[model samples]
Target: MAEQPETIKAFVKLGEFLGDYCQFAKGNLEFNEDQIKWLHKLDDLVARAASHNGWFTQGNILYAFEQWSTALKTDNLKKWLDQYDIQNSNPMTVAIIMAGNIPLVGFHDFLSVLVTGNKALVKLSSNDKILLPFFTEYLTTLEPLLLGYIKFSDEILTDYDAVIATGSNNTARYFEYYFGKKPNIIRKNRNSVAIIHGDETPETLSLLGEDIFRYYGLGCRSVSKIMVPRGYDFDNFYKAVYSFKDIIDENKYANNYDYNKAVYLMSEFKFLDNGFLLLKEDAGYASPIASLFYQYYDSKEYLDETLKRDADKIQCIVSSRPRRDHIAFGDSQKPALWDYADGVDTVEFLLKISNNN
Candidate 1:
């Protein structure tokens, strides 16, 4: 088994490498000769990645790298690992079935498996094929002991003791039926929402635009719905998010906007439009791309009860008031190493797998 501390060291180095690579992608590299050549290859890799998935714009992919670079810092990695007793004398191979909605979406599971001294048998999503491979190259090169510990396969997954599968609610039924015999963590579709107390400054609402438009609203962490005070006006909100009007310029997003808008119009659904985004009074959590669903609330008590009742469907609650599991505006996508998806701790699950073996 790879030593846990050594694995952490390798990831710290990887974080630094990613930081430098982000700078290179931003065209700020002066010259490192051999390293520059490697970065050029990565630049091409980013281009190919974008080609594979139109939603993966350069800015979004680079933002993913930047977030991972920050999360994998020496102190951050150490702090996250400190929470787990990761001395696995027997390391189990964990099968990770990932989703490709965003760049490197399956990485936390991959990282959890390896960081806990377990082998990772990964099944990459077709939409996000190249980004993780680049990280695999970096990590294995940094630590040769990890060479066999990490594996990626597109074929049928086999030879794994446990499973961690992420997919839509419909696909989750298939995963449970197939992988139910093994120790598993299965996740389904969940969306985030925001609460507007009608006290936010324009600057704060501007930051909320990042939560809405970043990644073109494809990530589960993206805010798709918001709860506002009854009779609340949205003039300030629209003005604040005007900075993100460029999002409609993306062809895929624009298509979604046009198609969904046409359907709403044909159906005679009352929705507010601002040329780039649609604000609809919807009680539903999931909203179509280029649209935001909102509901009116009368009291804070009702809001708390509603959120608690629908905890299973909510990923993150973007609010200014600090509370348990609530994320601030613009910060939902930038999760820490410990912030497990679906609120299930992946490290703890993998550690138990090692212990059981």
Candidate 2:
């Protein structure tokens, strides 16, 4: 069997595994009454498991599985693979450093390596090691052959054909310094933002809550800030977003919000009024809070310039205007499998690895 055919076979096997996983997710994991009850019980166990470490919480566990299942759909995986000519390349090893901000944030990198027929040496984040193993355990059960190719390591970072690293601006600098010599994708601190005109309805704003608050505003895809017209009243926005109050009870997230809020108040910084959150107008694109951070623009021209000036740091721009392909409020975090970050085609990157080998 040629390498390309073997690679294709692996992808087909993965697709079959994903199909089963999707069924399990939708039927058993997500909407199942029995499973929901089990999840509640599992939450208690997870809380106990991480009690000393102070890392994992019930919400984190739930969201981790939720994202894992969402990304595991057969159609989504197949769609991502379609863009590449995977049958041509036979990559040996691909190094990936997965991000830890959101649950299963590294799944896309995992998919890229798997579908492209490369052995994956994953450097899992300390904050996210537990969940990745859970996902791999399930995969092993589905297709034991896959267990041979996927390996997790805490140490032994090394030279590879290619690498992918996601991190903050400060960390990105270090990644570039270390991994820049290799064919690599080093992602810097970037964020999604919204462009809101006054005409946005309450329903739309509520959906935006999913973009802003889901995973407690941790994911890079999660909207960290908004661009609004000056003097915009936030009464409707607050009313819409109040439904997510439950997120505040999630220990780490609540602490983040409270801590940032306290720091702002203690420093006596002037911020725009949003009732629930203080929108500090700043020159930068990203903000600190788990809440929605926003900048006010007096005119459309100013908004355009602001976007252009910070284009490199911006990820997705959600807006009601039909001008751009801006996703709806809740849809930001739920990116389709085809959606690539930093304008880089992940499948293409993987294909390059396979082809170069």
Instruction: Please report, in order, the local distance difference test score of every candidate based on alpha carbons.
Output: 0.89, 0.70
Highest-scoring model, lDDT: 1
Model 1 steric clash total: 0
Candidate 2 global lDDT: 0.70
Error of 1 at 191 (Å): 0.4
- Candidate 1 on 279-329: residue-level lDDT in tens? 999888999999999999999999988889989999999986647778888
Please give, for residues 1-357, the per-residue lDDT of candidate 2 as tens digits. 223334334444444444444345445455457445534544444555356335445455455555545655555565566655566435567789988776668877887677666778899887666656655654565567778778888887874678889888888898898888888999988898888898888887788887887666667777888888888886767787888767666667667767877888899977654434556766676777555676889998998898888889888888766355577777777676678888788878777656666
How many clashes in each candidate?
A: 0, 0
lDDT of 1: 0.89
The segments of candidate 2 whose C-alpha lies over 4 angstroms from its true place after superposition are 1-57, 272-276, 322-324
Cα error of candidate 1 at position 92, Å = 0.7
Q: By summed lDDT, which 10 consecutive residues of candidate 1 come out lowest?
A: 1-10
